[model samples]
Target: MAFKLIFAALAAVSLAASSGAYQLPRSDQLQPLNPPIDNLIPLSAYIDGLLTNAERMKRGMGPARPSKFSDGSVTRREPSSTPTSPSNPEPTDVPTTTPGSGVIRIHDPSSSSTTLYWVSKDLNNFGEYGRTDDISKALTVTLGSDSGRFSIRTPSPACGCVSDLPFLGGIMGYATSGGDLKSSSADYAYLGATVETANGSPAVSGDNSFTRATGISKSIESSIWSISSDNSLTATWINADGAMVDAHILYYAADNVLSLTADPVSFVNNFGASPAVVSSWLSDSTLAVKATAAI
Candidate 1:
């Protein structure tokens, strides 16, 4: 009975093999053990291409499209043709005076001295003063106490103070532009020196001498200046609770004299006279400072 049972099992295996019911899978029929992952590219490559296309479009050129080669290489489409017109020329009416080593001269209205006073940088790093009549010598004076020299720069939109120097790294402008001149710097310090009410008169003070810990009050609006086509600098100061006044770059007689000690120049709204008197002087070009290109 045991021999007959073994024989019956062998017969069943042989019958299945002969009928091709039991067969090993061929190479083509085999399935992958793991699913294939899609190819990945760096994000920076896409960003760079986007920037490049944007610049090309700005220049009046056709936008570039990326193409993939049979060998799995990518390349940008070449421009159909070169741009016919030249890149936009810089505006001719923009102020010719650039931010660099330059001379700032203030008109002296006195009959005794008709020469212009050069705005010399102070050693205190507080404020600038008018001391020298010679333009050549004034340019040699260091801008601030630091080794890096300072230059007058205009922030974007051109509504800020031209006196904004590189030493402080600030954007001096009106409150509407962004923030007040007092809050231009990140540290909440004044650029150069600022004029504020002191004992009922305008006084010049350093960054540390601010009346408030957060620098000048925003309502004062003292440092915002405008440059004209002739390169003349002018500014208007408006007090939220007081009268609006025009800014005049004035200096003390003692500070203007060449001496061993000098004081920073005063930026005042008046010289013990009516505001109209100051306005006339500015209109006649007899009481203003012109920023010119450095020699």
Candidate 2:
């Protein structure tokens, strides 16, 4: 039956060529040839052999034998390198930062010092300073999407009775006077937008200025804030003039302040003619420690 099927396929090909639908070589095309009767095998048997060879290749083994019926052109299907299922997935590198609640610490990148951390100074302002003996002063940070919020683990009367104040008012810039980081109620804030006070007053203006008792609004933070795989923090925003502004955190030693600015050179150059110095632009190694579970 297999031999008859092969002959029928060949006949169809000959018919098509003769109709000028296809061209064939001017040779012994469609000419009947004598089969090697002594060595001839059924087409079904030959197909079974090929299937068997395929199974062997899947098992990462070579073909058992060369074909004797036709040209020795048996190609092997190489095993796929990709994982077939979740049960046997390839290993992947773990990410440094995962979305969720966490606490953040800062250190000196040059020295890898762990003593310094992100702390709330003067009740409302933020700065990177030593918090080695006072863990309560450390800021509990939560980040998701483009938004981030900072709060204290313990509220102190000295620092004001507020516990949940939006860090930097959810915008990247200098701290403003008469503004506290605490709110009388539980509220969230978005980045790159104006903040509001608990009394429905504008907390921080859209221009990054702060008024009394103001906090940012509850919205997704601006895309300006990004955390790299190494936990480096960077801020990129568009100014009113439609120009891109890129900035990194810098520590002003004299004022003990951490401010984000695109130009560190000018800030250092115009250091108020004082003996105070400003640290170099902070990088992930210097600015951020690995995120820890929220306290």
Candidate 3:
């Protein structure tokens, strides 16, 4: 019995020595021991071995077990807080058509309103017609009639223009260009009208001739003239007499009556002298008109 006890004690000692050099302390407060070697295993390895041994002891090795693995793709992950550089930055929304390039009219018969499009082109030009009292957005064509008229009245850019007519208002007629005037074109201003016949028609100097014959220095500075569908010539002018004139010269094709208004009322330099009171004078106002008639 004494020999048996000695043999059992030796076996226990051998098993303990083979298992590990020292027992790992249960308390987490203890600082784990590390081996002083070039290639040293971390404290976590010892803990992992301990856990494996404990698990093996609980469930004895029976058969080969399949290893478990987590899929990186299937794992639910959070978006990175750090911004990543994009290969191609997202493109911004761009408009298909440019503003002021051309007119885009929308007529709503249900609402009985026609929406006109007139974007700002030149520096002095505005986006909408008739924004100024002298100008009109009357460019709508009559249905079944190949005739339309639009007038643009604007100040000469930078107080300087080809006419050298001070910073006065000048006009552009869409009808003069046969409704083909492009706002995008650089030659859409008075400066573009270099000669009398540069646009489509020459300004009628018949009135100027009449005034000159009467010993008057009355002449049209920048004028846009168009013939109406009924063969009537409509002329809008910036006259040298410092007045804006809209003349309707009618000559009936049937009767051959060359009619002109006698004693045509003239507006003062700024239309604020006889008819308009000087109290409500528009100091820096001038009138310029250009009409493009269907005829």
User: How far is each candidate from the true structure, as Cα RMSD in Å?
Assistant: 31.3, 34.1, 44.3
- Between candidates 1 and 3, name the one with more favorable lDDT: 1
In model 1, the Cα lDDT at residue 102 comes to: 41
How many backbone overlaps does candidate 3 show?
Answer: 0
* Model 1 Cα lDDT, one tens digit per residue, 1-295: 9999999999998998999896664444433211122322212222224336664443233455567899989987443355444387434332223333244455645445667555443322112223455543332211222122222322211112212222211212111222321212211112232322222222222221111112222222223344554656444333333333443433334223211101112111111111111101122122213333322
State candidate 3's TM-score. 0.15
lDDT of 2 by residue, 133-199 (tens): 2434433344434333221122221232222223333343232222222212111121211222222
Candidate 2 lDDT (Cα, 0 to 1): 0.35
lDDT of residue 254 for candidate 3: 21
Best by TM-score: 2
lDDT score at residue 104, model 3, on the 0-100 scale: 14
- For all candidates in order, the CA lDDT equals 0.31, 0.35, 0.25
TM per candidate: 0.30, 0.37, 0.15
Identify the runs in model 3 with alpha carbons over 4 angstroms from their true place: 1-208, 221-223, 239-245, 249-295
Ranking by lDDT: 2, 1, 3
What is the Cα-based lDDT of residue 151 in candidate 3? Answer: 31
TM-score of 2: 0.37
